[model samples]
Target: MNIHQLDINHLKSLETPFYHYDMELLANTLDAAKKAADKRGFHLHYALKANFNDRILELIQSKGYGADCVSGNEVQKSIDMGFPASQITFAGVGKSDKEIILALEQQIFAFNVESIQELLIIDELAGKLGVKANISLRINPNVDAHTHHYITTGLDENKFGVPNSELEKAASVLRSCEHVNLLGLHFHVGSQITDMNVFKSLCVKVNEWKNWFEERGTTIKVLNVGGGLGVDYQQPDENPMPDFEAYFDVFDKFLERNPNQEVHFELGRALVAQSGTLVSQVLYTKSGIKKNFLILDAGMTELMRPALYQAYHKIEKLGSSNQEELLNYDVVGPICESSDCFGKEVTLPISERGDLIAIRTAGAYGEVMASRYNLRDEIRYVYG
Candidate 1:
């Protein structure tokens, strides 16, 4: 269910400027995604970078999904949340010595090694620990995700995976690292991706690279096509859940792999975006000769996507008034910066002081990216 279906009186009484998570929707989303992946013998790993709320992780773990972590603490959090170490895959461009050591000690599934240098470091750390580290080469496939430039990750210029030009060098380095065991390949183009053709193109790149390694007598066991599925930010109610069937169908139809190979996905946003909403109370309303404004207690400090990436989120005024006139209002936050605006010319009903507002489709990056920039109260969450 969308935020509009929530009990207005209940939300209004507790607080303003807090996250409201619909746990039922989250469960339904997870069930749908898992069913689709399991039907195709594909493994799913929840990317903890999306929303690492304790309860969210607990519910996700209860579904028997793996953990895709990018930080040392995330790895530990997954462990603490009861995600098996063997189901955890640690991936990032720069892995500090401490992080690498932690992952090694935990014996995570594999490290999606980005560069030849990182491979060497993992090997050194693993050697000191007297253990072999399983690693998957994170390859830069150069496929454009057709997303925001800041989020695009697979291009040759991106600071992520090892580019094609360096594969030969990486292979040579891999052969020398006695403590590092090569398992497979990993590719992540970008996030908030909406196009299906992008996945088809990625399959072509994965095929080319997979064959390139097998030709050299390398036995590839895992093919991790990292997730970039986008949710409907414009129309959350219309498309509450991403089409898991269609998404998995793209890979199952196009990707070529050995019978023994295992496919993995690192999904974050698609599974949780629709289940979250940012609720706030309108503090005041202002009218200028040119524009109207609805000042809210919530700011970029509460939901930073609109300012950080120019992201779009549908805004809804709670407690519908059948006779209230619809008017354009620029929704803004109390943050000091001028960029703290949430939406410009946002159309809403006649609003007033203490009017409730719901910022839809904020479940993914909203609360997780919040800051205490203005010494704002620690973000709170309400689940139903």
Candidate 2:
């Protein structure tokens, strides 16, 4: 069933200011992505940073997808959650010596190295542990992802991967490091990228980098073009599966590959965003001379995207009979900060005290980023 239909029955039972996740919808979305990736013989790794809920991780792991972790805790969590260490890939900019030691001890598949210094650190750590650490260089392809400036990471100005000019030096450093095994190359442009041209551009950049390495007598075995596929926030119902077919097709057509090379992707939001919603209740509806305000019990502490990025999510009233009565409202939450508002001048059905409200498309970065600010307690979560 759709969100509105599920809301009719579940809204009454749920406590206010909670997260609601539709497991069926999430399963379908995962299936679609898996099917598309399997068609091209591509490996998919679920980026745990998107939503690290144990239940979500269990479902994703059950689907045969690997885990992409960025921290020591995440690597441990992935292993604890039944994901094989052999299917896990650790990635980050500043990996601590402790983290490197842990991964080497765990024997994870590979480490997505971001800099030459980090590679040296890993090599040293692996040497101390008497292990050969598998590594993949995270190269900054210098391509514009054209997403939100805050989330964009591939640009030369960003503090993410090794610069394009440093590849030779990085490779030379890897060659001398006896404890580290250089596996391949990894490129992640940015996040929430809707434009397919960005992926196509990334493919071109990957091909260029591959040829550069090949010409230097280096054989790249794995090509990991990182994931930033965006979902439809305006109309979740109209486009639930996130156009995985088109996303994978772009890489299939543009990315150049060798016979021994394997392609991999790390996706997070496109898999879990649409499956969850932030459910809250309207605490009060105040009418002023200027405009109406619908105050909610949930605030930025529960879902901060609105205040952080001025992002939009479809706000709907649950179990409302007056759907046609149009009224403008500045939806806000009970937080000390004025910036804790969800939407301004939003049109919704005539609202009242205790009316249930659901913020759509909050599954990815919503609850995972929640804070205990304003002395607020954690919200409950319901899975269906």
Candidate 3:
């Protein structure tokens, strides 16, 4: 809704339904995060799954941040974008053989190995390549992220990290693997986490597990507390950036570590969400007895969070008239699916065809999740 950072006149001339990125905001966010992490000697690896826009990746890489990749292509993209192999970390529950080999060839910093079988397979592949692979055990701390169920990943039921019951076996497998080097432990509770106490709970689990591994005679080098810091979707303007200082302070204050150990984070949404906006033009306005609908040229094909997660993003009618009249309407996209709606009962100025609408807090997952499901046009972007 607050788009003063964007060139409104230029936005009006472009075709409707494009993502507009505020490069300055992104730079500031990165600087703030980097300074916070650096002051506490924490390391940051930007999660590429969040956006991965070429320009965005270029800027993020320019800042010397590491890459947190979830797939094979992502690993290559990070390298292609100039992120050093030593700064890239591959993580996923279902990694393919090809991905493993590519990562092995790349000599990435570490693989957040999720299962004992994955550990054995990586070791086997590394042995075949005659190279030692650095790995960190992705431990399922079972800590609740207290966020969306769809985004939660650290619970016992989630298929992300290895369960506590299997740690003994994982250690046994690690002891037997000749080509794999144990780096440390990795734990990602979930995504879009807002509660600081959730992280505190996670710190407790991390400490417990680190001690658990140490008691078994394994030396820990890195403590990768995966990132899930939430953004202010409800008020993106008021809080354009997350409190990086407080976030890092949480780890500094609570997380116990040794002088030789390193602290790392894999942040995705918090770094980019507020810096992007989805701009679309109203296609039509239809008023019904039960519901009023403002159809837009964009839909779930463009931004899937609403349809997929019932997510809330601040929607505002741009170019409000001096005598603007407010009304409640269901803002929807022109897609054929009923779930294509963006927001229901959204209050905005009495809008008409050609009126511009800005969907805020969309920088992270919005553009990356776009699809051609409805044979829609390829998404476009505008940067300022």
Candidate 4:
């Protein structure tokens, strides 16, 4: 809104549905994140799983940030995109033998080891490679992120990091492994965490764990509190950037880190989610018996968060003039599945066929999660 970022006229001339990325907004967001991280001397690794577009990757690389990869392909993409192996951190619940071998060959910075079995596999593979595998045991703090259950990962019930009960035992096992060197402890409460108290709780747990490891004479070098800062999905135009300075300040104030130890974060949504929008066309306005329906060309295949987590995204009518009357309608999509609906009882200006509709706050997970369901074409990108 500040810059009249997207051109409504230009959007109408283009194809029906496509993802539009605000390159300027992305630059600003990255600058803010880096500046905030610099204030506390924190290291950031852009999570590649968020958005792996080459252009996006290139911009991130140019900012002198690293990559946080969740899979083998993501790791390789980071490398191929020229992100130094020293700066890349790989993390996932289930890593295959081949994937571990691939990462071992790449000499990745550290593996956020989730399970004891994964620790052993990495050690064996690293032995075969004749290289020491750097790893940080991902410990579950059991601190509730207070976010959606699907996105929350640090709870005891989640199938992610090692639980608190078996952590000391896992640390002992990690210490005995010859080929795998324990860098430190890793933690990720969840994604879209807005409460700073959760992070403060995580810090308290981290301090306790650090003291526990130190008692066993283990010198922890890195403290990786994985990123979970949330963005405003309901109002991207009003607040294009989240308070990264405040976010970093929370960790700086609470996390009790050793003087020489490094602090790192793996941020995805907070970095790129506010920089893009999904633009679609109003295919038809159906006069239904119960209520009106605004059928859109874009659906769950193009942006699946609403269907996956029942997420909220701000919708706007780009081509509507101020004189147009506003009305309430269910914004449904062309997909056959009933779950493909974007929003229910949405109020927008009077819209008809060919009216351009813009779905805001889609940069992080929108284009990346697109599917070819119903034989519909996948999302195409247009950078602004």
What's the distance in Å from true for residue 103, model 4? 0.6
RMSD values for the candidates in order, in angstroms, are 0.8, 1.2, 1.2, 1.3
In the range 1-384, model 2's lDDT, one tens digit per residue, is 456777466576667898888899999999999999999999999999899998899999999999999999999999999999988999999889888898999999999999999999999889888999999999999989898888898999999999988988998998899998878899999999999999999999999999998998988989999999998898887877698999999999999999968999999999999999998999999999998999999999999999998888989887777646989899999999989999999989898997899899999999889999988998788888
Task: Give the TM-score comparing model 3 with the true structure, all chains together.
Answer: 0.98
lDDT for each residue of candidate 1 in 1-384, tens digit (9 for 90 to 100): 456777788778977788989999999999999999999999999999999999899999999899999999999999999999999999999889999999999999999999999999999999999999999999999999999998999999899999899999999899899999999999999999999999999999999999999999889999999999999999888898999999999999999979989999999999999999999999999999999999999999999999998889999998877788999999999999999999999989989999999999998988889898978899988887
TM-scores of the candidates in the order shown: 0.99, 0.97, 0.98, 0.98
Distance from true location, Cα of 79 in model 1, Å: 0.3
**lDDT score, candidate 1, position 99:** 96
- Model 3, 264-362: lDDT tens digits are 999999999999999999999999999999999999999999999999999988767558888999999999989999999998999899889999999
Model 3: which residue pairs collide?
none
lDDT score, residue 139, model 3? 95
What is the lDDT for 330 in model 1?
95
By lDDT, the better pick of 2 and 4 is: 2
TM-score, cand. 4 vs. native: 0.98
- Candidate 4, residues 114-198: lDDT per residue as tens digits? 9998999999989988999999999988889999999999999999998888887797888789999999889999998878888
